[model samples]
Target: MSLRAIATFDVSTGGGVGHGLATWFGAALAGPLRGRLEQEQQGTAFFSASTRATERSPRQEYQPLATGWEAMRQELLHEPETAHVLYMREHLGKPLVHVRSSTIRVRRPNAEAQLLFGADCGSLDDVAFCAGAVEFLVAALDTVNPAFAWLGADAPASEETNLDWVLGRRVRDSVREARKLLRGYSWTTVCPEELSVRLGGPGALAATGAFHRVVPLSAGGCDPAGDRDRGGVHRRGRARCLRGPAPRPAARCPAVRPGPPGAALLPRGRVPLPRVTDRKREGARHADATARAVFSG
Candidate 1:
């Protein structure tokens, strides 16, 4: 089995699930995951849908967001139950990394948005990237303001059950390394079932100052043991909260190339570009992308 990590959020409030997804995507591309996704020359974003067969043949569905990021954002902002967005990095016609988001439906009362890594075509191994992604999601709690969120391998099951199916040595090592780097953070959980119960419902959890706030476990910092006793949750690690306003695209960011006529305007505030200062750094980034491709392959 391959290594996997999931971050689930209760995005039923605020702007609903679609808006939450848009916010999360923008933050991800503009923040920690920028180096991996923006620098690549070949990338594609698409919506997946199932088709029904008619008496004659199967009918095709016209997807507006299939064009690019600008269109995708527009749909996500307006649609209530939009198709999940899948992003892929391509090299020589082969896929390197695949990032996917959860789909929100109209009838679902309490919709949730989930960001998955290494669950589809790839296995997450970059410790730095994994840690950065987790940090970004935790910080995003303020803007997206999901009632409850947690990050860890698989779903909110017992640790033993979650890791029981692991058969490969490499996969095991990846899981262990991810835990080591992510432990001590309040949202990082080995078993989400226990945390959810302790935290109570979404309203109660949000009132605990855990959402939209970064509570680290350091000297004089928030205490997990004490928090647990007081009907709260805290881990034994230190992480800085991404304070202040949302980040804007730097001047050095790549200019949005003009698409064909009638194309939607790309949102400047959310666009993310690689910031390469020197040749050595560029080479290193490329090497990292290659390593990801190798691992996924």
Candidate 2:
């Protein structure tokens, strides 16, 4: 059966059974998209709480910040429910795309044709997207009802309150379907390897004892990654890393560029100026090479 059909059947049968059906379906269908609705319940309490926390003490150390899109993604990875809600909000009100509705003419006892409702099957890709979407809803439900994830078939028959096991099973099945669909396409699950590298590698996003304040670069402005004024000192070198307070080099230091390969132009010694007694003809020859390399570029 198609993924949409599977999801639709669960929603239909699950809803037909009771009073909380509409609420449950709304929660399920809305999923992470709740924040976009502007209504109270739809938006998460996390955002509200965070906002209040920020307001209470503006300079509080507990304030969370993201440096860039990649950093923001890392934060989201740590908070899946919040991420899903925001993700849904990002793509709010887009067509479901999987379930196509139509009406067909059927023969009636009065020798007249009457309209009957029907559905058009969606493509596998559409089904896969739907499956992914439904997985988000399942997660949202699980969040509302604690321990929903742990409840399973092997646990106990007595433990299946409100068909929690059934719902859990449905979610697991849908997730499996999503993974299967994903294999057929190029989509893959995102993990923390990239984040780990970004945080720990030599050219890490934030260096040790370094403060990173994210500032947006306007169009036509210097890229932040290369802007020395905002960056920290290069750990392994005397020069400042990109985004640090390295001065504009064009008018002032005609022969000096702050970072490599420009750095190669400097002589081997740490200090460029030597005492009058130590300055020799050979030093002049080295200076000539440095000048040639620097000005030639």
Candidate 3:
């Protein structure tokens, strides 16, 4: 119930499973900080082809310029098997929080986690980019392969194919289980594609997204000293994120500080500036009153 947002992503050509999983994790991250509530309930999401598996999955493995991303886009125009997910948004009916992961490895038995998404520092794409994305609902799940060769059956019956559907139903039934573990709630359903043809709901991990980064709230920010040159344009306004080429202030603002209230007002329309604590304002008022009293005498 509290997870008003969700995101799901996957590498386009290879590592589709990992790509799929990251989006859900990312969306869970960006939901609660409390910004303006989005007018539409969800946002678009994107999935990059896994660079990790690019070399392995013939479709996308190529030079950086060749396999970097452009080639991945053109390929999506043709088939579903490609790892990148560009169609999920318009088709799936949910918002997506697009993301990429570099240097990912499945560490098992003992368990250690680090920043799993970026390739390294100093790259824009090295940070999270939810846009420049074709969006969709990403409903992903890992369930016990329902069709596990039934020991007694000769040719696995159509019932075997229906295992995934049963899993989806399980997900719906155990939706609260995920909520309790995560300490937040959202509707969950098992919906798998391409793995098996039978239709039964499977238990799943689900989330939502759109027009967002869906990154962790505790995410480490990008560099700052790199952005100090832009001058006064942003200082007078709201804060700019230093993650990239944004402006920085504190050369100090030029607005002149007004003198005391008792000070004679110049013909120009300037109100006395309020002091931080108000003691100055009171002192200025008292002096102004004294000056007026002497002038009258």
Q: Point out the worst 10-residue segment of candidate 3 by lDDT.
A: 288-297
TM agreement with the true structure for every prediction: 0.40, 0.17, 0.18
Clashes of each: 1, 9, 35
True-structure Cα RMSD, model 2 = 27.5
CA lDDT for candidate 3: 0.20
Put the candidates in lDDT order, highest first.
1, 2, 3
Candidate 2 on 208-269: residue-level lDDT in tens? 32222211111101111211211112322222221122122222111221221212221211
lDDT of 3 by residue, 1-297 (tens): 001112212222123433333432232223211121132224432222332333355545422222244544344233223232211234343333223222222111111011122111122221122111101112111211110110110111111112112112222222212211111111111112321112111111001111012111111110111111211113211122211111222222222223222111111111111112222332232222101100000
Candidate maximizing lDDT: 1
lDDT over C-alpha atoms for residue 274 of model 3: 17
RMSD of 1: 20.0
Question: Highest TM-score among the candidates is held by which one?
Answer: 1
* Candidate 1 lDDT tens digits, 200-241: 433443354434433432111121111221112222211111
- Local distance difference test, each candidate: 0.33, 0.21, 0.20
Worst lDDT run of 10 residues, candidate 2, spans: 106-115
lDDT of 2 at 99: 14
Ranking by TM-score: 1, 3, 2
Runs with alpha carbons beyond 4 Å of true place in candidate 3 = 1-58, 65-67, 82-297
Error (Å) of candidate 3 at residue 223 is 29
Q: Give candidate 1 misplaced runs (Cα > 4 Å).
A: 1-12, 35-67, 79-82, 91-98, 103-109, 119-127, 154-297
